[model samples]
Target chain A: MNPKVSHPRIKEFEVVTNPKIIKLLLDGTRKDIVFNYLVNEPMTVKQLSDAMKKKPGTVLHHVQKLKNAGIIQLVETRETPRGIVERYYRAVAREFRLGISERMSAYDDDTVASKDRVRAALLGLSTLGIHISESDFEHAHDLLQRLIDREAEVAKVYDSPSNHAFQSLPPSTRYDVSYRMSQFLLSQDALYRKTLSDWHDLISHYLRKIESEMV
Target chain B: MSWPSNYPDPEDNDRKPAETSAAAPSPSGILKDFKVGFTLAVKNFLSFGLAMLGIILITILLLLLIVLFILIPILFTLGLPFLIQLVETIATGFQTTTGLTLVMLIMFLVLPILGPFFVALGAIFGMARELVESDGTQAESAFSWYGKRGLSLLGGGAIHFLITLAPLVIAFLAISYPTWNPPSDEELRVIIPLIVVWIILVNGMLSLTYPGIIDGLSAVKAAGRSVRLACQFPVRVLGAWLIITVLVTIPLIPVINEVAFLWAPIIPSDLLEPYGALAILTLLFVIVPAVSIVLTRIYMILTAKVDATYTQGADST
Candidate 1:
């Protein structure tokens, strides 16, 4: 997110995601595990090491790598039992959406950046419960593409606190946000297509009706 | 392969086919995709190139076996008259009639009928499997997935042909119908427009293979879904489909020309043989599989799923 965008109510900030930082995190398994923890909270090297049951020295190296990539930054200084100055570091942002880039899109084969994106995506495969077939490959490409486009729109609109549309919304005006991942075998293209049309029609009808009735 | 650092024109606004605004990025989008596909293919060029070479040799060996074992015996025993004419013309070495015609017939008929099936199983589908599995460029793995899926390529090719046949059938009836009385200019106008619409409609429906293959849905479901998708995102689908069609077809030019020349025999047989064989090898091994890899990467990008951060407890600050 551009810093110029204001976030009047947000205590925690969001980042559009730096591809360089993501590559650093995904380059190794240990770095991935460390990132998973530090992204959760701002923590000192000892705290991270203890949480993962690893040595502070080992965790320090990973933290230093992230710091160099500008993915993690020092937020505060703490005095420990021995009066040593300890720096608490945190990931630059709480959320990362794949950045929209023409250069990234140009290559047909996966580049280092694209490969990192896939690795990040697979981190949630177990929870997302994904399954794909041969015919569905093309369709899946379309779906993922649309999702990326949609995500970019949301990030742009809500980028700054001052510009956020939902900031001063009344309780009734606020819409709940829901996220889901869908997977289907080769047998369900028709059912899904019909479902898409039905949902669009139903949503439109209700929206029109609601417009006619005063809120 | 260089894309401008900034994506200046998303070109999605007024992108719906129903909307009559801008022409949309359909043509340019497909064109842009080729650069991406080519670079990606080049990255793993060495291994993929070798794999294609191996498949070409295997295909040649298989063709020889088929000719020696099946075609020769069958043609000699059953179609003796055709063989007699072929031998007589060759022995004379003067006129080029029987041998050339037979060769042309084989190239025209066999190429169309079986070429697609071989490509589907051997290259496109095979490359798709390798891509998803992430087995790094071991040449054999690219082709290893060929027989794992039974007759999918054949089945998919049939589905495309069947869909194509719909509008074709309509046009066939409209143009060829015998009528004692000729219609007004208005009737001729209506018939042409109707036939054109049918052609566009059928091609849109034919695009279901991508979604169908990813979903593993039957042909019918894929067809319906593909149409729905086209309706919803016409510009994008049209762009992608156009680009993919061209990329896949370009590889065939060399082989097609070579095959056409094979039957004509204008050049000396010994002189022309090496180049023709090399072209066939390159088409089957290098270009086709590279195209397949490109398609698989596109599919993987579009179809991949990631759980929301909220679900992952990454947002619980």
Candidate 2:
């Protein structure tokens, strides 16, 4: 009944060295058992209920909560008698990792931020993202960390004038953006290939703009 | 791991789906895909059918339990015992002649929605497992990822509904067309072609949705993947759909005629018509299981190709 929790279908969760996801997943014990049982194969709420000795409705509520938290998904659906449709839900992945992607300190305790702050940081990251390479990332890890520090500082300074020389940009000049970052590989599918091509063009256009600014 | 060992460099550039599909080897042809599908259907015909049947029965049993659960409140309200309430409800359904609009509404609109998604998910899981595992474990493996990815599967199903929604809308308009405007042969030009395209798109995507789900893509991504695959190999997907439709339809010719009260001579005119039984038999034994096996096989290939495209992407990167 807590209005704070959103519907299970829309909630995005992260597994990190944090209990936040675990909390969002619901009380630790039941979800732990449910998660463990579901690790090997998919099961309907009924099957899970019978096996766990929980009522089907109770199991369904937990399952939906877990699913909404992005831990589970529907694998298939079918039409039955009349127009009734049944769904089978399964965990999103076979294995669960209770850590961030780096398995480190969840971006060194800086990944957590207000939405607008994170969004602004992400916009900068994405803008610079296209140009960075594996070698560049490795060589500049420390530098990147410094940049992240600056980004955090900037967001922190947004509401207060800076003690340091770094002044927050005016609201008119500030922006927030979010983009899905993935290491896309080229493909043979003409359509997929065209998407990549279009992406490359867009990125090139941005890179050119960056170059112009630099000049 | 987050620090990243690999990332696509700027030179990796943009690549579109058409380019990806085209650069890739031709998809498993419709005939070959059909042959593979048929072989799969034949190989696991009984097991797959039984597995599907098991899922169907299990789902129905769950729905029945749900009905019982709901009936508990009414049972107490009616001053009747639990078992008696069960009997009364069933009796009421069959014996009562007066209108039960609420009951009918729940049965048709609400309850059907509940069961169909789960049932479809179960079949996909089962058939996908059967196709992939090729062992005794396949039957149970169908439910392997059930609780894990419920949303994705739900999303996938929803995406499919949305994809086919256009056709439904078109069909509605076509049905309503004469009401608003005079029917003309020119409408056929648009309607017929539209129907053909919709059929290809819908059927092609239908076959590939599972493959994408099985590959762990979300419903939206799966639908997109299926559409790309369909566009790449429209003929194969369409042909496979045609072949399967024909196979299922061939057996139902007599049943169709019997139900339609048409030119079916297979049954004697004086014979009693178990029309309902015939329809159930055809659907449960033949249509559901056959479609499962065939589509599973087709999508399995498609999923592999889909995977290959990614690996190919990785290699290029």
Candidate 3:
């Protein structure tokens, strides 16, 4: 039986534009509800609570949050034998593109500190069946930090008005040029490329070593 | 691959209406709170301040009358010399055990009476909430809740006061026991951290209690709802609490009182008085009202989740 046939309202993909919605979806249980249980089939809060091994009250709270964010929607309601009305919820979209907003791209240190960046990288790597030891992970994370620091330095140079060749341009135009140039340099420039390659080598070496040990 | 323009079926009876206006509290929301609070404060400063001032004066008068009523009997029963001797013994710690017991008894008697006033502090939140929602609060609205609704708020305030004073009461009882021995350095190490955790957790849980009561919940239900919200959004609740604490403490900074006098040696002495008065006025009219407004908004955002979940939860159960 195809579960998706039962819920025709679920979209194939959704681009999450709201930062608050994105942050809420990042929570493990909420992420599970949208990406796992609701994606499989529409479930009442009681069913979700049983499947997730959480209290009905807790599951209901998360459901409320997701519903409020427009990531989930109530598809129907059923009256139980006891005359209780149970709400059945389904994911609004089967997949979400957690896009970075302009505000989020500004890189507030407090929002995405170095440690959180490292943790996120580790989580990303884990999805690829690459498991590095704690010691090796820490070592590779330092290389990653160096790569970030070098990119930041390159960006700082572009940001300085005196260092720009477009200094004759108006301030707004110069700013636009500097921003695009910095982004281009961070992606393609040798100054940033060297740091990236070093980090890549360190991470891949650990991966290869770990795979060999497993074999 | 594509969604229908009419995604939600309009005829669906169980379909929950979207609450676009209800915002959940977040760390990011804390930054915007101050600006919102300040705007509301500036708009309704005179009315709110006068209302607050009236509450304080009335509370003081009532407390004074109560104190006199209680004191007259004491003075009549225990002569002046005996009353003086009792004060000296308590102040000097001469009769240490007796004095400690007497002090504890007095606190037990006084704390309950003070509960209504503490809950009365919540009237500020209620008024600020009205101003935030543009409900057009009047100065007389402050004194309007002195009836049954006031009692419910008093119940909430009593709950909050009792929770805060629980640790003190426990410590006093433990030490007063005949077999009790004072904790050593090692015990102190563990005990102090535990006390700090208790304070933080309790503060976060009870932060929304009064706001919940003001929203038409019973004192106990409001407290339970507060606990649920705090448990779910611990970081947001604690962060807002920390912000409110900092705002309230700004007036107490010694620099505000001392800075003008410190520079008085360089500048003329005549300018210092106006500076002091200006500082006091800013603290009274600006910071105080803004803090109240910010706290009310934070409470609203945090409990907005409760409204959606619990109301739905009620139906399912």
Q: Write the per-residue lDDT of candidate 2 for residues B184-203, one digit (tens) a residue.
A: 78987787778767865586
Query: Which docking category, incorrect, acceptable, medium or high, applies to candidate 2?
Result: incorrect
Ranking by TM-score: 3, 2, 1
Residues B91-139 of candidate 3 have per-residue lDDT tens digits of 6763455434655766767775696586557667666655543334666
Candidate 3, A32-101: lDDT as tens digits: 7877788767787777777888755456557867886788886654333322334567888777664444
CA lDDT of every candidate: 0.47, 0.50, 0.65
Kindly report which residue stretches of model 3 are placed more than 4 angstroms away from their true locations once superposed. A1-215, B1-25, B72-95, B98-103, B179-194, B253-284, B309-317
lDDT of 2 at B294: 54
By DockQ, the best candidate is: 2
TM-score of chain B of each: 0.51, 0.61, 0.70
Candidate 3: CAPRI quality band: incorrect
- By TM-score, the best candidate is 3
* Superior candidate under TM-score, 2 versus 3: 3
CA shift of B278, model 3, Å: 7.1
| Model 1 ranges off by over 4 Å | A1-215, B1-36, B58-112, B119-122, B132-135, B173-232, B245-287, B304-317
How many clashing pairs per prediction, in order?
34, 83, 0
